[model samples]
Target: MMLKLRVDNQEIEAREGKTLLQACLDNQIYVPNLCYLEDMESPSASCRMCFVEIEGTPQPVPSCTVQVKNDMVVKTDTPAVRQLQRTALRLLLSVHDVDCKNCHANKKCELQNIAKFLKVGLKPKRLERYLKETLIDETHPFLIHYPNRCVLCGKCVHICRGKHGESVLTFARRGFDTIISTYSATDESSLTCGDCDTCVKACPVGALAVKESS
Candidate 1:
């Protein structure tokens, strides 16, 4: 069933069960987001970048987690929404290594695109930058993981699990210490990732890369 919604004073039609973020995106309305994928059964909403103001809502909400409804009024460029998005992006940048010149993602990085869209600089002015001590993890025989460049969006993990019944890549630790961990050598040898590069391709930040020799 198609539902009609007014976004930024523009009328759009989206499936009833589609998320507000997806709905807006489908209609050519841009909303900054990182942790959302169209195939996700349940959006993590961890990025907190897709905020929008809906009529009757006291505060801005993450559009990725909200279902589209008929006659819904959404404002994607409200002041409150921009404030939340900027703050969330700044927080991500605080811990992110912003050496884009040398990074593989460079001009194509999602973080850079989001920063441009929000008119926020890649560096956080008020927040002090804190990067992980370990720069790269070559534990995986076929892949290289860059901790500092990672946004912890979990797209790689989700894509891995979707491709294989189970994922060899999983999030480890908690809070600021969180990082993606791969399976043990013995376990990884039995998995199909040796022949797969989906996870690397799914990463929006180029944090994961296929080893050249692999």
Candidate 2:
């Protein structure tokens, strides 16, 4: 079955059951996305970068999780859409440093690409760097942790708990205090982490990662 939908004022037909992101990519719309694994069934919608305005819908929709429907009209680059996307990116950047020049993923980071695409220079909100920095554990020999740069996107949590059978990481605490930490905040090498690196790879930002050794 094919579903007819409009994106950015252009009408196109796509597979009925595919997600909106899949449909857009299939149609070559290039909807910006991060924290979305290319071949995974999981649609975490953690980054909120693929938001689009759907006809008859007051609020924006997450294209990654939304299934295409007949007569669905979407506005991907409208003023409202841009504003929302900028807001989302700004919020994410608020918790993150603007030091892309010296970062590991300087040229390869999705968050940086999205920020560039949205033309976001700096967040409207004041920057308040956290005083307490999370430690980096290199004992696992496969991954590193830099919680200071974490945006609480839940991508790591999704990949750890969904793609990998081992539930090593999860969101602990709540609200401003919320952070992604291993279950019981225990040492990763001491547990059943499997060291798959799926969570680290799924992370859009450099929160959880396999650091390059010198």
Candidate 3:
């Protein structure tokens, strides 16, 4: 059933069970997000973007994790929401390579899009810049994994699991050491493309991509 929700005082029709993020997009409202994929068993909320202010809530919440409720009041651009998003984005940029000039993702990149949406600089200023850049893994015949550009969103992991009934990509380590890799980071033979580009296409950032030379 279609239900009406109030977003920034604009009423929009959204189906029940749709995440606030999805509904906002459907209604042409922008909500900055990187880790959100529509069909997934779990909401990673990894990127820490997509915050929206809800009335009566103590603070802004991740719209990707919030289901649309009838008469729900959502403010997507509240000052508190902007503050949280800016902080989260700054941290993401700290470790990222920030080499957009020639990067494949370029204008299509979600990180770039969200950074523009929030009017936040790609370079981390107040946060200490991280110097470690994970080695680029070109093990796969068709795909490349650039850990330096990864935001640990897990979109590739979910897509691989859904399309193949098994996950080739998985999260490794914790904290600053965290990364996305195959069970065998050096095993190119384990990859079975099955004629599907689901993983590469589902990637929000350019962390995963088809080799141009493939």
Give the clashing pairs for model 1: none
Kindly report the root-mean-square deviation of model 3 from the true structure over all alpha carbons.
1.7
TM-score of each: 0.97, 0.81, 0.93
Off-target runs (Cα >4 Å) in candidate 2 are: 35-46, 122-132, 135-141, 183-190, 211-214
Encode model 1's per-residue lDDT on 81-133: one tens digit a residue.
Answer: 99999999999999999999989999989999999999999987899889899
Please say which candidate is ahead in TM-score: 1 or 3: 1
- Displacement of the residue 120 alpha carbon in candidate 1, Å: 0.9
The Cα local distance difference test for each model comes to 0.92, 0.73, 0.85
Best by TM-score: 1
Give the per-residue lDDT digits (tens) of candidate 2, residues 1-214: 9888888888899987788888888888977776565446767787778888898999888889888899898888878778888878777777675667756667777777787888987444565544225545444445676665677777777667676576677777876667676644445446655546777777777777764651
User: Measured by TM-score, how close is model 3 to the native structure?
Assistant: 0.93
Residue range 46-154, candidate 3, lDDT tens digits: 7889999999899999999989898998899999999999999999999898899867889999988888889998987788877456558887667788888888888
Instruction: Evaluate model 1: give its lDDT.
Output: 0.92
TM-score of 1: 0.97
Please identify which of the two predictions, 1 or 2, would achieve the higher TM-score against the true structure: 1
lDDT of 3 at 27: 93
RMSD of each: 1.1, 3.2, 1.7
Compute the lDDT of residue 26 as modeled in candidate 3: 94
Clashes of 3: 0
Of candidate 3, the 10-residue stretch with the lowest lDDT total is 183-192
Top model number, lDDT: 1
